[model samples]
Target: MNQPLTLEELKQVMAEADLLKTEADVEAALDKLAQEITARISESLPVVYGIMNGGLVMAGRLLTKLNFPLEQGYMHATRYRGETTGSTDLQWQAPPSVPMAGRTVLILDDIFDEGNTLAEVVKACHAQGAKEVLTAVLVNKVHDRKNTELKIDFIGMDVEDRYVFGCGMDYRGFWRNAAGIYAVKGL
Candidate 1:
């Protein structure tokens, strides 16, 4: 069997294969995303929502980049856990601490895979009577849409369905802290 793609291998592919598009090179893109989020909701103190589990690392990283005062909150909306594919059934584990009613809310998520989690979170935000609801994501998989109405207002990268890990995305419920993103070797 072939060796799994390690961090070094990802770096090699990133350099040689031009695997990441220049327009959305990871670091530059992240900086742009931070700027975009800052511009959209430039309030004194904004209630930022993190869709837990996957979004944990990304939201944390992005929050540190903001210039304005920010309050942190998290809600767990999961369509997939450790499984290779997504499931239709979505479960919300926790709700935001800050009152979402009539508040500026910025939702940070890991990936726009099936769109289920994104769509559900949007609905949840509305249900909480958010003054305005916005979204940001690390990756957007351009597959057939399970929920097309939802869109990622800010994105770090658009990736193919090769099972990515790192940059807040995960495979087998691990590898979130990887410096660069990676893919599974066989499937």
Candidate 2:
């Protein structure tokens, strides 16, 4: 509301968050993810599900980099729509269409905040009978591992909660367009 964060302040927080990834770094991560997806796409994978809204840009870009054929789908799940603290309860707008019975599924999200969302999503996938599920995320908020006791299978970039906007991440829904990524400055 109060001009959230100035460019300089944003830079400071990003430095504190240890988010030094440049624009090139983001692209390279996508490139690497594409290759990883391709390697995992062998043997008729069932579906690649993206946690909607936030995962849009990252998944869209990664989808282009896929060299092999892969089925793509979307599932809307909101954990922190209007709440400041991330939500532990996930609400799905729609269930995935592809059968999860003993099928391979790839789950993707924008950021790893508190691990609650990731953990619940993985649990849901398994509950639906997914034989094996691989989780992937673009930004890893390396603030406190003790708090976020969850592990990501394929990580694109390692950053703190400070440097966490752009390329799919957003700051109050404003800084998502930032090219190089940014960090929130104050409370």
Candidate 3:
């Protein structure tokens, strides 16, 4: 675990961060994502699971925009326990909260970085007997280092390859509540 940053240091980090997407921009993207998702699965009565910690904000915001009736749940699986970098293996702190067997499953995550965590979660959904599994992310970090073949079905936005935080993403487990998206300076 990393030493928690002092309040002053955390403020300095935010002061030095570059704002990539404003809060309005994120809200607009969520509106669009909700529309797209509804067009595809509004009638499927899908089981939506948010990958916790990171997906909490995204899921909460997106769910309000989606008018259709669907079951909501959460799972906690992470490669980065509270750091910037990720480990090779996934850690499942909590499994799916609802059964997806023979049902359509939709997984929501905050970011699709290297894709390993999202891919593994999708695989797990399938293994749990989901008739179909789809993945969505609030942000897709554009880079060539993606290690998995999984393609996100719905994406809110594409961000440059940088250490980004905000809109449910965190910088060393902080700033996940920042209304806008930001890239850490020099990261």
Candidate 3 lDDT, 1-187, residue by residue in tens: 5677999999999999999999999999999899999999999999999999999999999999999999999999978777667887778899899999999999999999888888888888888899999988999999998866797999999999999999999998799999999999999
The TM-score of predicted model 2 comes to 0.80
- Clashes, model 3: 0
Q: TM-score per candidate, in order? A: 0.80, 0.80, 0.94
Each model's lDDT comes to: 0.74, 0.73, 0.92
Report how far off residue 17 is in candidate 2 (Å).
12
Ranking by lDDT: 3, 1, 2
Per-residue accuracy of model 2 over 1-187 as CA lDDT, tens digit each = 2556678875565565434578899899888877776777556665788887678778887777776666788887667666766767887767776667787888888787667876877888889898888878887877765335466877888776564677778765655656666665552
**What's the residue-level lDDT of 68 in candidate 1?**
86
Best by lDDT: 3
Give the least accurate 10-residue stretch of model 3, judged by summed lDDT: 80-89
Q: Give the residue spans of candidate 3 off by over 4 A.
A: 80-89
- If both were scored by TM-score, which would come out higher, candidate 1 or candidate 3? 3
Given candidate 1, what's the lDDT at residue 121? 75
Q: How close is candidate 1 to the true structure, as a TM-score?
A: 0.80
lDDT of 2: 0.73
